[model samples]
Target: MTMTFIIVYVVIALILVGLVNLFMSKRKRKMKTQRTEQTLSENDTSHQSYQSKFNIRDTDETSEANDANAISEENGKLNISNNSDETEALTSDQNAVTQHEESHTQEEEINEKLKQKHSAFMFGKGTSQGKVLIAMIFGMFIAILNQTLLNVALPKINTDFNISANTGQWLMTGFMLVNGILIPISAFLFNKYSYRKLFLVAMTLFTLGSLVCGISGSFTIMMVGRVLQAIGAGILMPLGTNVFMTIFPPEKRGAAMGTLGIAMILAPAIGPTLSGYIVENYHWNIMFYGMFIIGLISLAIAYIWFRVYQVTTNPKADIPGIIFSTIGFGSLLYGFSEAGNNSWTAPSVVITLLLGVVFIVAFVIRELTMRVPMLNLEVLKYSGFTLTTIINMIVTMSLFGGMILLPLYLQNLRGFTPLQSGLLLLPGALIMGFMGPIAGRLLDTIGIKPLALIGTGIMTYATWELTKLNMNTTYSHLMVIYIIRSFGMSFIMMPIMTAGMNSLPQRLISHGNALSNTLRQLAGSIGTALLVTVMSTQTTQYVSTYSQDLDKTNPFIKDRLQEMAQAMGGEQMATQKILEFVQKLASINGVNSAFLVATALSALAFILSLFLRGKEHYISKE
Candidate 1:
């Protein structure tokens, strides 16, 4: 149904545009014919005047021999009159030609404006590259809105479903899974379609998904809606990065992308807080509905300000590449999803992990051998690009890993509500949002490598600090650490993207962008899953070990257990209290360990950045 809808709309749009072109062409031909007739009339008048002057000169020769001096003066006066008439006619012809030329020039300028307007949909429109910057800003805002809008609604969803923290996180995990699976596919689709049409389609789908989510009565239905929205996000997220690079000349890509980074970092960070406020004051459904409205507005802009009817050469789909990507990514995420519920030793978890590994291996082999590949593996031949991509992956892993772990820690262990947990992220998000653009402007003057190194170093240090948090840590302390950590990310994110893209050839920007976005998605998936799985495993182990020491015979243990029971006051409540305490304490310890691992990941990113060679700015077009 979606495919058919897209095709029909594109055809109708093109037909209308074809008619407009036809009208303009016919008008130009008519004007050209009229100008030709006027030029012919001017030539005939000039020829007649030349013949009269010759006739008068021959007659004067005969008359001057007969009448002498008196007739000579009369002949001179007649010659002056003829010359004056010829000069007046010549001036009149010149004026007519000049007026015709001016009209033609005006028409050509009008045609150029029409051409620019037509190109705006597919390639975007502007004289000074300002439109490229504007499109990027819009893309950035949309990306941020997609994720952040869900934050406030997560708690309401959890409470309504009566689910565990792990189960409730599916709101986020489901979106990630769908988005992760489709990123490569988006790359293929983007190349095969017009940018304006694709963007509008994405926005429309997103809006429809939001409406579906708002009306859903069941968890399954809501998840289905989320899946729909994820498809749009999957495409747009990558599109935003690549489109800017394609629209702008190489020299300004960093500055442009840097401006985009503000929205990128700001969205996820702010999503939770805004979601919290909306859900708390109103209802969860309202949040989704609001997103729907925003999507519609974007769609309207696309229709009015852009043209989406350009044709494309449909490349053969890479079947092997698609299979490998789907299976590899699908199985990997499945393993993580299962780990949230099932033990690592469980048959289901084991099988999923094994399949994921096998598919990933197959994907690598297929990409290496294909002639016209979906993912161009040849770019990896450049050492700087390869290392930079790896670093990007590592950085995203740690960033997303913490995004998952931190919220869970606050809600499950510290007994904070969803609103409070989201609030906790606000300060960090605010700091990073403001800093992103500043970093971009700085990169324009200073080198990308230095800025990237400095940012990663701070991120590494921040990760180490996060590893030190425990159950008893104060909110104020966590807030300070999060702020510092976010500030560091603001520096690293834009510079790396700008530098790597700048290094690529102009023709390779699209492919390079596709690869970069794909890697970031992979990193987020791997990082989130690893963090969750490790926390779950370690928490269960800690609970079991501690249970052995909490026997009734141990005096200190007995006293502590009795005190907890008395604080609850009822037998049923006492048992529940003990279990909750055990779970909460275990989680705190597990999260600290995860943060330590994140620290290690950030360090690896730092090492990879060192291999990124010298800074490469986008090459300017002549």
Candidate 2:
């Protein structure tokens, strides 16, 4: 189908979905109002019962007192000594007091029971809780899937738009930048809005963004769509975790959380392969269309099954803290991204990097002093969390570096089709997804230290192998190495994260998770930018060296150029071919050099893994 037709179809679908959701919401609101009225009526009836009982008791006490007084007056008027009557009146008064006390106690007990019942009814254990969770997971899966679905298509996008690689990298970097900025705000959003409301808004934004992307004819519009999608995605990510934490009690949380982890892992795992196949065989717009449809379905399900499980309180946002965080993260991302296009020594790069550092430091200070910080930097105080975060950041950088560079190497250097390139990584992605839960199980059975050691060892070996990639490298060879690397990654991410979180007090666990998530996003962005910059710089250097050598009085080079000129029918065509060959050769060598750097990063992460303490140490803190 044509892009226009597909975009139109998606827009229609979104409109229909929006209309249905609006109708459903209105109906739901009406139902809620009716339920509230019924509940108020029940409470009023209960209150009236208590009032009636008090009123009757008071009347009885008044009648008894009047009778006692009348009897005393009669006794006095008759001048009759009646000790029995006096004793009876005293006993009657005691009985009345006792009865009144008993009635009041009964009223209080009944009221307490009513309150317990009302609470249980209002926050009743949902029969469809499992369905609700499934709906949420589905939504979260699609949102996260969109995050990486375009990674493999970036090169194609650059070619189609005639944009430079540096400009194209923003497709990834910009998405991460938006995510990094929005994730911290999620705590405030969750506190201020109902989960159901936040979810609807998030899904709506995502669906709308997908439609915009599907229809976008320009890079700027595409980026705008991506940013909007990121906003929704950022909200949904933490929203999923928050929902799970609220719905499941502590004992059942492990299994629920494991399922959540599966969604997170599996989405990105399959994204490239899916994007590859689509981009290869179909229009890239189809990817957005598919996501839009999935998002629409998820929204419908959410309308039917999603419930607010936690009470929300109005929480004030940390405005200064938010501004500082944005400046810090945004500037850092901008600096790194620009470094790919401009030299590292460029004034823009230097100034932005400095500003990023300064602002981040100031943000740290502000968070430390604030009564309610946006990010809760205090979680870093826990030794295990700090260690795990450092390791996680390094691993994240390495992972993102590979994710971006591999596509370039496969497509640009190796001349693989997008589909072929995506297929090359499919096995590894599947293996990673399969290994995630197994690693979690292992974390439960064994611990983090052993897993970290083995996983990091495997990762280091695979990354070292990657550094040796060249034109002659076979696809099967790459696949095997990637599978091993992915398996290693599965072992490293969850075990270390679980171990670190385990070390934290219950109160700090959420903050630790947030911190971990933010750092991962930042690491990915910085890593992609840094690696791309290195590759670009190295490529330029290699091209310069080749050009200078070509200008020298080398007989072999002269003979090759002359033969090429005769074969191509003229010096003009020959010169063009030589230039093309030089560019290609430089690009391959540059990518190889970039991989070498990635290898060094992997080595550093491996060394850090060695310091990971046993689970016993982290668990002891809890």
TM-score (all chains, Cα) for each model: 0.73, 0.75
What are the runs in model 1 whose C-alpha is more than 4 Å off? 1-128, 151-155, 158-174, 219-224, 306-312, 548-583, 617-622
- Count of clashes, each model: 4, 0
lDDT of candidate model 1 versus the reference: 0.70
User: Clashing residue pairs in candidate 1, if any?
Assistant: 121-307, 148-271, 152-275, 152-276
**C-alpha positional error of residue 443 in candidate 2 after TM-score superposition, expressed in Å:** 1.3
Worst 10-residue stretch by lDDT in candidate 1? 1-10
Expressed as tens digits, the lDDT of each residue in 98-180 for candidate 2 is 98899888988988887655433122345366876788889999999998798778878888888887677767766766676
In order, the Cα lDDT scores of the candidates are 0.70, 0.76
TM-score of candidate 1 versus the correct structure, residues matched by position: 0.73
Candidate 2 clashing pairs, residues 3+ apart or interchain: none
